[model samples]
Target: MASSNNQQPSPNTHHNPLFDEFRWVIQIRHSLEEDHDDDIGIPVSIFNVPKPLQLSKPEAYVPQLIALGPYHHWRPELYEMERYKLAAARRTQKHFHSIKLPQLVEQFTKLEHKIRAHYHRYLDFSGETLSWMMAVDASFLREFLQVYAVEEEEEGKALRRLSSRMSHLVDYTGRKSAHNVILRDIMMLENQLPLFLLRKIMELQCSSTDAADEKLAKMVTSLLKELSPFKLMENFPCIDVTQHAHLLELLYCVIVPQSDEQTEDNEIEEQNDDAGAPKEGRQSYGNSGHVKQLFNSVWNVGSTLNGAPVRFIRGIIVSRPVKFVVQLPWKILTGLPGFSILKQPVEYVFSLQGGQENTKVSNPLDASVSRPPLVEEIMIPSVTELISSGVKFSPTNGDLTTIAFDVKTVTFHLPTVSLDVNSDVILRNLVAYEASAAMGPLVFTRYTELMNGIIDTEEDVRLLRERGVVLNRMKSDAQVAKLWNGMSRSVRLTRVPFLDKAIEDANKYHDGRWRVKTGRFMKRYVFGSWQVLTFVAAILLLLLTGLQAFCSVYTCSRWFGGVMNNVQKQN
Candidate 1:
């Protein structure tokens, strides 16, 4: 009877599928809990480049010359730099006298978990491997900085000793040649050590007399300035030791520096905006009080001083619903020289510029030369199209931080931007860093977006070149246009503070019936061909001649007929 009952199929066996499902859920829950705890207070500096952003330019974000961190430490192509890394490590040991590789490895071993926490991706290397990697890479970086320091301190000493790839590194930063690919590699967000690690190494390396942090800042800034394609504005933001999270963060600070007051103002403005924010696509700028906030008062007032001008309806008016009374004759108003500048002191006093109440700190990033606030919507015509539409391009003395399009003057004031082989890698990495940063200022990204919209063809590049806005060291103008076009694919468009006004002005101009029709006419008829124009002119001339001939013949016939009739009457 017991055998018969057992053969009837055990009750638990029938419910095995349910038990397996329960076990699976339990495992998933445990994993979720473990991940949550692991993520607590993790210092997220290096991030795996998001898939969407990487699709545009994958190679740009990855290191090609040297690997700085555990992320790409053992890539086969990059294995060539391993020997250079070893050489750098040896130099580092020799410089420090007693400090050896084993001691550095020990330090790294103790700080492994903390270092690992900074990276968002799961690293496959075991504790021993990670520690060894950090030691070697950190040594390489420290020695790299030492090379720069030695070069600056004792000019020709380090130059003679540098070999192979190290020799190329020096040249890349100095002359900017084919080997300058290394410059882009080192600046990538993924290829970074924790600033704390570098700081620790600096502290160890510096003698009791030297200011380590100051020296470190100078070294980093000097290195970055050498590699950067963008011109660093004079008195550009100084690197604060307290502010940087990593090397990439340091680069970011140099690229986009904001004063403490400005940062606070931005934060307060953001909070206020968030407090009253509406649903997406329903944002009203008119009531938000930031619509005409493109340029600082300095720019508007400066533009006014130059003949191209802007007048504040605010402060000048005594009451609500301010009235502007212009009672001058049209000829006098239009032709009178310096008429706009008659009330220079009064206009300056009653300006609506933001920093009027207090003496404002000058922003190095601000446009050095001021132009009138753009009146039309931002129309980003191709460089060729803009030139065809009577817009002139002029080179600004200022850097890229001061790029402006003035509609009133019909001129685009742009800093001379260099386009070369290294430009793509440099720009792509800058864009990637900006995209990944927690609170990255989108200055470079915005500039790229603006350029992308304007440059649709090689002709645009040619126009920019003619105007001296671009210094093309690359293969072709088409490549320049293509580079800009490729950049904005993954970038989510957002409102850029200064560019909003320019964009509005451009859109208004592009969308205007007169401008569109005139452009079309020029492209279709006037600018089409000389043969077409000549043929049309000849046809008109033939028609006029035929009419003249007919009139002359008719007049003669009438005169002859009148004479005949008179003769008949006399007979």
Candidate 2:
């Protein structure tokens, strides 16, 4: 009312707290709208490690040397690395002769919204602060990753000349412990920088776009090969570095190459062709299908015995009168003096020769015609147990796809794995990354679980090392055992068809042995139920004691005699 057309209003008129809050909410709404606009089409690839995953081995997931992204950027413990990061940023600036550090930061500021969208968690830093952080982190990462770059002969000299500060921190030869620790930090789930930012930095440093792409790809590939536990084969597929989210994702792609279903079908077909299996039987049996067909031919004669004479003999043998007559001869032969030994031999020979002819006729209708039960879990024996059970362990110079179990030779083929102090950290982070990002099967996680299952004790590690399947760079076999055991604590059960099939084959082979069968029977019947059997025995002993005590007090013999006499009199 303008204070009633001239009268002054109180100063508190517009000072209502409720009104102030409403305006503040409007401001917040606009800010959120802006944020939503920035995140419209961007997909989040980086994630803060879940608390449950961190709780098992917090050090493995947390960066020990440097903080790469916003997730752990403010941790006081990692603040010491800030000076080094700044030094590396300065060194990186020298490489871009025309583009200065400030210009690089400006470019990052322009991409701030895009950078924020990559992280799953909310970033509380202002645009300027976040941009500066990305610039510095990307610079530091670029400098460190230079050591792993595949340098050409012309550029090798220039690439080898790292700054004095970085030289102490990152050894070109990767012999220093500090260097290894930084490498581990770079591979952590939380300490990941977006690959786009790295690409932008590389593009700015290089002469042209194609050169930057080529250099980045080479650097990433070399880094993966250096850090990977599995030795990459010569024919390993090339990975598109730009397509990945970060270094960790690129490394995962290198380790677990995605093969299409059609390719797998083709490989199976090729293997069947190598084994000379018929096309019609190819799908039913696996690698050993040809061998099964060969064994199946042993009973094929039964099919040829389907004539009238064979049918008449079968009908006569099935008659009840024939069965009675057959039993009379054996009974009479066994009853004769000095003919009992001959009776068993004659009966055994006749049964052996006749049983085959009868059994083969019914083979088509036998229970063997039914499909075997499915193996739900991968339940292979430990390394030591397999060796003791006469199952052989051999290292294959191929990828995870090369894991095979030969039934005839009782051999288990596994890929060679090189282990070191940082191997556990690398493996744990890969597993965590896969859990967060994978849309298909967790093949790497399944592989880790397989190793954990087969390595129960130090002796198992020793046996694997002896066979060159596990290259142990740790202090002892016990350390290797402990590392695998600790990794399996948070692992969830998963099934990879090929790995599971290999495990099933190994278990079947192990179970088929007489010693293993005997041991299983003893464990299932004797040791497994010892407590219940003991309780039943105690109850029986107690009842017997009570009966003896009653006999001591009252004459039980007389009681039984009187009952018997009464029964006889009644009869």
Candidate 3:
């Protein structure tokens, strides 16, 4: 490549083909109409991912659409709730007549307890539990999202009219739960998530047409809010929805490249990703500065068997303001962490060229790196604690009710100091993100004394605050930031062998690292060669022994088990 220039690439133009194709993807995503029981993998709630253009397969583009949104993150969580709701519903309804509401409540409560207990059962000292958890969650959610089609034709017909209405009603209530009767009742009972969903359905059914429309829109918007982790990020306990993003990205890292022809089809892929590839390159120039919905944003670019220009786009529209940084917000991290989060927006303006193939930090538009904490880390804690401290979750039974709250002031903890977002030195090292981000907060804070090789549990990714690693990450940043401020630009942030030192191996990491692909390949070859030699030698020895046996038999010597050397060849 030619020497890089200081010039920055252009942002999204108001309207163009590549940009349009990307817009088309977003439109298709905004229009995803799914059934309440549909098993669309991603939550039907995150939106605005631009579809990718077809460089080679323009024809295939007719039949395929590109979908990129909370495909990894939000979909899985929704899927879990979907799966848990469906399964719990299934289990409860299985032996229907004999089961009473009290029994159902008791059974579901046990299940909720079980799920929590099973989740925390194994905590090893390796940080690789992240990878392991990824595998398990994917499988569990898959099973969870199987979308059990309830067999109630009459009820279904009734639900159809009311379902959309209730959706609107829930939206109208927006964070106003007390006004909604059924929802309030379920919440009071500490009822299952499915119950909450069903209550939401029931409320939608009871809503007025005009009133419900606004409410449902607001309700969908509220759900979409959770798809993003912004509101609760202010007083986060740890990394929020960031892990979910990593999980989804990791899954894409696997599924996107493995596609072949129709033969190996998993059946469900046709219903899911296959339906979403078309709308690439087809966005309308009609609407500008418009806010769109993006629930489970999916983009496909292809024609189905009959060829009706099929483009499947699914996702939720997100209206939440993007907060690119969330951990302690830098200002709270006191010393080092404070310095890391303060970079102005212009810092990341240069590398927008090719973040795709280059997963390299140098790619001006590397979108996969850090942005904010995930749901589990920040939102759940915030919501849960908010209610505990002062926000009330009233789960009532009959006339008597109980409120769940343990009010307390939350402590603010920033994710330690590191390079600012606009830092050019940091963007070029994309591969090292996983390795470095593991300790992102710690290393940024220069807390190595706390991070020495010992891993308390797999989640102990606090290596970012350690001193050695911190000083190491900053050398290049110091020069870049200073240069921008008209200080000396002579300092170079020396690239360290980060990905090389990415892992640790106490009881801390998984065995998969040493057992990587190359090692396995070489091991197979080595075993194959050894097995071949052993086989050949065995055959030769057998032949030689046969000859010896023949002589022994001929000489009337005992052999063959000398089984008398085959009874002396049947003498």
Name the top lDDT candidate. Answer: 2
Query: In model 1, what lDDT does residue 419 have?
Result: 77
Could you give candidate 3's per-residue lDDT for residues 302-374 as a string of tens digits? 2222211121111111223322222233233223432322121112111111122235434211121111111
What local lDDT score does residue 292 receive in model 3, on the 0 to 100 scale?
16
lDDT of 2: 0.72
Ranked by TM-score, the better of candidates 1 and 3 is: 1
Score candidate 3 by lDDT: 0.26
My TM-score estimates for the predictions, one after another, are 0.61, 0.67, 0.16
Sort the predicted structures by lDDT, highest score first.
Answer: 2, 1, 3
Which is the better candidate, 1 or 2, if ranked by lDDT?
2
Best by TM-score: 2
* Local accuracy of candidate 2 as per-residue lDDT tens digits, 443-462: 78778778888998999999
Off-target runs (Cα >4 Å) in candidate 2 are: 1-42, 150-161, 259-378, 489-493, 527-571
Better of 1 and 2 by TM-score: 2
Report lDDT (CA) for all predictions: 0.60, 0.72, 0.26
lDDT of 1 by residue, 1-571 (tens): 9888878976665554424566566656754665445446656778877677688678878887788888888789888889888887776666563687778778877776678788878765456678878777877776666544555556566666666567766552356452466666777778878776776666666774246687777777777665555552566556766457677767655655343333322211223333233321121112112212222333465555421111222333323432222333323332455332223222222221222233352311122112221111123567667666677778764545566668788677666677777678777766766667635335666677778878888888888888777778788998998887777442433334555456555544443435665565556445675654675577789967875785575564453577788899999
